[model samples]
Target: MIEPVELIGLAAGFLTAFSTVPQSIRIIRVRQAAAVSAGTYFMLLGSYILWLVYGIIQGAISIIFWNVIGIILGAAVLIMKLFIWKD
Candidate 1:
C-alpha cells in the first residue's frame, strides 16, 4: 500500500517539477537572458542532482521521479541560457 506521505511527495514533486515551464516560456518569449543567471541555474542543477541521489539512496520513487524531471528541465534552461544568451 502506498503511504500518505508518498502521495504527498508525489503531488509536491509534480508541482515543483512542472513549475519551471512558465519561467522557460517567459525566457523563450522575451528572448531575454538578463534576468537569467547561469550560476543560479547551475546551482539548481547541482541541487537537483543531489536530490535525485538522495531519492535513490532512500528508495523513494516520488523523489526519484520528480528530481529526474527537474534535472532535465533545469538542464534545458541552463543550456538555453548558455547558448541563447548574448550577454
Candidate 2:
C-alpha cells in the first residue's frame, strides 16, 4: 500500500528544492550573479547539510531526500554565483 502521506512529503520536497530555480534562471540569463551573496548560499548550504545530518541520524528518508536536493540546487546557485555565471 502506498502511503499517501509520503506524497505530501515528496511534494513539499520538490517545491522547496525547485523554489531555488528562479534565482538560478535569473543568474543564468544575466550571466552575472553579483546581486547574489556568496555568504547567504554558503549558510544555506551549511544549514541544509545539517538538515541532512539530522535526517540521517533520525532515519527520516523524506528529510534526507529533500535536503540532498536542496544541497544540490543550493550548490548550483552558489557555484554560479561564485564562479560560473558571475561576471
Candidate 3:
C-alpha cells in the first residue's frame, strides 16, 4: 500500500539517518576524535533538529522517525568530540 515515492523517501532517510553509525562506532572503538570536526557536527546537529521540528509541524512520520535517529547518532558524535575524547 506504500507509494513508490514514499518508499524512496524512507530508503533515503534510512541511509542518511544511520550514516553516522560508523563514525560513532569508530570513535567508541578507538576512543579518540582528533579527526572529527566539532563545528561540523554542531551544524549538523542543528540541521537535524530543525528537520525534526519541521517533521513534527508537517506530521511527516518518515521525516520525524529518521531525523530522530539522526539527532541521536549525531549527538553521540558531538558529545564524544566535545566531552569524552580529548581531541
Question: 1-87, model 1: which lDDT tens digit per residue?
Answer: 989997887788888787667778888899877878889888888988999999999998878988999999888888788887657
Q: In model 1, what lDDT does residue 3 have?
A: 94
True lDDT of residue 66, candidate 3: 93
* Model 3 C-alpha lDDT per residue in residues 1-87, reported as the tens digit of each score: 989998898898998888888999999999899988999888888988999999999999888999999999999999898989976
CA lDDT of 78 in candidate 1? 83
Number of clashing residue pairs, candidate 2: 0
TM-score of each: 0.85, 0.81, 0.91
Candidate 1 local distance difference test against the native: 0.84
Q: Model 1 residue 18 lDDT?
A: 74
Q: What is the lDDT ranking, best to worst?
A: 3, 2, 1
Candidates' C-alpha lDDT: 0.84, 0.86, 0.90
Pairwise lDDT winner, candidates 2 and 3: 3
Distance from true location, Cα of 49 in model 3, Å: 0.5
